[model samples]
Target: MSQSTDFDLTSSQTAEFDLTTVAFKSNPYPILARLRTHDPVYQYTSSPDGQSTWLITRYEDAEIVLRDERFVKDKQSTLPPEERAPSAGPAPSVSDLFDLGMLKFDPPDHTRLRKVVNLFFTPRATEQWRESVQRISDELIDKVESQKRMDLIEDFASVLPIRIISEMLGVPAEDSMQLHLWTKRIADALDDPAAFEQVASDLQAFYTYLLALVEKKRQASTDDLVCKLMHASVEGDQLTERELVAMIFLLILAGHETTTNLIGNGILALLTHPEQKQLLQAQPELIKPAIEEFLRYLAPFTITTHRWAREDVEMRGKLIRHGDAVLVSLAATNRDENKFDHPDTLDITRQENPHIAFGKGVHYCLGAPLARLEGQIAINTLLRRLPAMQLDIEPEALVWRTGSTVLGVNHLPVTF
Candidate 1:
């Protein structure tokens, strides 16, 4: 469906757009274009508390918000008195296990914390996992090859990453399913504040699980990533116990969820645009560039993490008050016509694809290389194994996930 005619800007007030709806999640590009053109620095008042969040839609402005030091990620510390959200109190039984990791910190702290895990994500480090990724891909494809039909997300994409992450964390194969359930529930709970009670329960359960796992690793001193993280220190700087668990939790959540979305969204994009699929299948070598295009074209993350202004600032003719929340729409910015030629079109071979799907600057996704590696291997393997695969349901009948920061379908049924 072409969104040019599907959306009417005048139907509702310009700033009334909300991402937590099925309508918005189904097709956000048109609304994104409208926002980019009319109000690059848009403001929307959240209900109940009347909290305001400045949404940066255009490419240039969104990039600025992401990289600029004035815009800090941890709003709890920077937000002004009235702007600050009410205290939700300490973690009841989980302790500080749910605390934000390096992703939420800025400057020296962010730099310090990122260093511990940085080595594991480098291209060289990621390459070490490529063979393992290929084996996992082949195993997954083998399962579906005979079935002829599968729910791609649950049966394939979702399984690959969780398994890999569990192995990396030293979790036994038998316990993988439980870990997957915990992470999935926690990730789903992100946009639903009403799920706080359930979320708290899940967090405590997950925290307790990790605590036991960490202790097991410590007693044995294995070579897994978790064991390495436990022993890692720099210049007399070591992660506190809470930081250690929180970082591991962050790793597992980010490590799998984003890659799962990448694979799910990438396949859906190609399935919807058969020409692109044909092009990729014919050329075969375009998988790398195709990965970039998919990241830009379908941008799994609609917006980057929330940021708050440290002081009053003016940009794009708008005065952002101090402590005001700012969110950059990665999906919108990647599709900004001002930044790319024919931004809406999916050109698998397009060069100069500088999309911020993984974000930018100090906060650029640490697991990006791994995600890309897994994506390339997974998609290529899928196309190679099931060249005749097609969707089992009508495109419009497909449901997009609601009330979630990560944009993906809950289930993608396909047949070959």
Candidate 2:
């Protein structure tokens, strides 16, 4: 990535480049491209709180931030004593619920939490679910096969992962829809900070459900990931009640949400790029690499969760002060001209692809293998079963979900 000695943020550009707006979420590439070229380390101030966050756009800079130890995930540890005081509130905020997960921790603690369930998500272990994933995909398609038309996201993409993860976590089949609703609201809150209060009730209900589930597991163990975690330990250190609840919460939300986007975005890519779609149909062997292409061309998580500067740091001549929020744009880094040739083009058969859609470094997504398995089976089964599948609505008429953290369509209607 080329270094930019001068930073330029015109008043007009600043006004138009607001990241929180629906329009920006719908299409952030053009603006991200401009930032990558001019201000690789741009500072964006939130309109509501006026808190500034440094945005890392270029591939080189993004890699540095992701891998560097100085950019920590736990901001509470680095904040000054005065700023660290807990805010008085009637109930815990949605952000508080999120901070309990492993995603919000650094090594040692993060390592310990991940180690308890790491065996379940390994590449080899994930293969065990291939048949289960295929069966679920077939069953989902069977329901809509005769309908001739269906909302792909609602009827398929979203359902497949939730069912799989629910089963893995030993959650009852009947409760899948309820869990889905809760996770969706939590994701929406993460996307739009303003929606936190609106979704607090749902979040609390979800938390209560998890508490009950944990207690039930304690009395009776089963051969499921959740049960295994309840007994599994590293160096004879077992997970506490709070740790267990947070672990299960993270697994449920991250497991299905990211894969849902993977399947949704992957199918959308194929629908728009006819040639690539045809190529994959003709050569089924390309499904694995095609999934990688989808992750690259349209990353599931556009920008990473906030990482705070442990201390004053300089990158590309920009100063990121201690305790300041830093975010790495995975979407921009994947499309960096310096890394991938013709970065915007969708090429399923491309031989040289190294995208960080699941992210990189210590915090790399643990459910990536499962997500790839689900995407491969879901996309391939859809193509094989409904060979004539096509978008039911005009491409431009589709509405994108608010917020840039996760990239996906709200609903994908399709016809066979």
Candidate 3:
């Protein structure tokens, strides 16, 4: 059934949008547009906080909210909770991510940290890693070359980026494999509130683990980015130890999480859409466009730009109260009717996507270039090298991640 036809929006409970709407999570565009017709900026009830927040579904409206100064992206600017949020649960990795370094700060701090990160991850910097990325992609593929069946998630996507990040961070190239457990536990916890508590514990453990590594990087300096960050000054100011750890955590998080999802989602999309897959096979030259199309099609980030309105601001006729959390729905805006000619169709050759997959404005993703290079090289290599690769499991047999605001897949069993 169509996402719109699946719902009875007139019902009182249904009128108040809940995140449980599977259609909204997996494919929310139809319902989002239906609601946008009357309330482009609707108040959506979030399961995480158990409160209502503004949600913009239209491409134009969402863009305005993302770029506008009135809606503060920093959560600290909001009324600090009546009390500090109860931290008693799984790992509180996201909270740590924003608080530890650049992700948390506003203007001067945000700009400073971002500038430092950009120095190493910029497009030119990304080009420097092209050969390294391609080598890693080719090497990883070779591992599963003869295997008739493999779990693409763990065996491939999950491992590749993390391995590179470990090396890039001046991390002992061999011990990078250790980050595997930390990334997984932290990623899983972000979705489950119960898991979130565990995340707190895990985060402490990760900190202990990284503390040693940071000390090591400090002692044995090299020319690598991590070493560079160790000595680099931001706007004539040096990063404190606390700030450095946060920066490292951000690198590992971005390095591993985003690209893993990007590849997983891209692989899943190709398997599901035979036409698009065949199109890529027919014209290999379209890999660049196809990669962008796939990222737009997958859209893994689940509203990273969560904010609280500084004051009551009207968005598309909706009253956004002061101090209300505003969650930007990227999946909704990417498919907005006004944004694309054929919004839902998997058009690999699509041009002018300019989707918010990497986010927009000052808060835009710093690792986009690296993610793109990794994705383009990875996807192109997989297509070229694994010509016989096809899904080993049935479509119905697949299972999606739980409470993953940003998701790819749990497993993609494929055969060569």
Candidate 4:
């Protein structure tokens, strides 16, 4: 990677930072900015109960690391056999095992898995889902409009994506409320160790619920995604039962989490910054660029991608040891001073806004088109439909999610 930031990994001293605390939780922008400028290749070591990982915050470094295949995703292959198995004694839930969805796979596996999922979202295929997406958004806003200062998260953002994904998977709307809670709990547990046991339990329940749904799909002939996978074959290879379950888990959570934050955070940003909101309201055509800028401006996934160094590779002028976790802080990178001019400033009309919020390389997010369509439809429709859309409370008064693994506000109360 060019424009390397040299650092000696061996002799480095560590800093104390709890990724899941109120300070970092309430606001991470300042910390991200500080790390981006000062400690670009910062190694965050644990104090007592905390776990340590290297945090790469700069634009160039994040781009280089996220795209580099040498920093691999299949750290499972490198794990000790004891660590590989779930406790080595009892076989655990599917979540405990190496869940190799498209995100978990590397290279050829990643390519193949992504291709199968991409078939559902390709430009040609996406047109069919548009009507469904629009219908979902309108119904959601209808609910939102009727509420007494509804939360941007629970009332709108979180539910819309869940409905879209659940319906896509042929999961009945009756099942959506529980499934959405499970997904949120799973995300919460991932970000906060305090929530791990509860999260794992929720995950098991989610898997169990999904299994029943899969069985229904198996017996019936439906055009939902689970059936699509059941019938699909690639390179003469059909997906195994375990793989199918894993795919459902991955797709639902991935689709639900990131886009929810996009809608929630995007709304927060526009509401917080009135001038930008006014500009968009004046010219709704800017929604496309505005969405791109929003993704960059408030990147949902803090560290969207993580990898382990393959074989002691030299990147950013640092010798990263094999099996070491390399994280690209997309949250920090999106507002990177080098990659984006006025990175912290949100400009809906910016000529060039290249953000890695959807990720990069062969592992780019397949659902990006669908997410964009959903986001644009939601934002534009809200502005046009809501008689006088505005935040009912101060931006600071809203409760930003604590230990938010993927950055989002828990509550965004609004009035129309």
Q: Between candidates 1 and 4, which one is better according to lDDT?
A: 1
- Sort every candidate by lDDT, greatest first: 2, 1, 4, 3
State which candidate has the highest lDDT: 2
Per-model TM-score on C-alpha atoms: 0.93, 0.94, 0.89, 0.90
* Cα lDDT listed for each candidate: 0.82, 0.85, 0.73, 0.75
Q: Which candidate wins on TM-score?
A: 2
Cα TM-score of candidate 2: 0.94
lDDT of 4 by residue, 32-137 (tens): 7877776687665422455455678887877777787777777765576676643212443656323556677787777776666677877677667778877887
lDDT, residue 226, candidate 2: 81
Better candidate by TM-score, 2 or 4: 2
Instruction: Indicate the TM-score of model 1.
Output: 0.93
Q: Per-residue alpha-carbon lDDT of model 3 for 211-255, expressed as tens digits?
A: 777787778777777678877876687776666778888789766
The better candidate by lDDT, 1 or 2, is 2
Worst 10 residues of 2 by lDDT: 86-95
CA RMSD for every model? 3.9, 3.0, 4.4, 4.1
True-structure Cα RMSD, model 2: 3.0
lDDT of 2 by residue, 69-178 (tens): 99988887688787774422344333445666888889877888788778889999999999999999999999999999999999999899999999998999999989
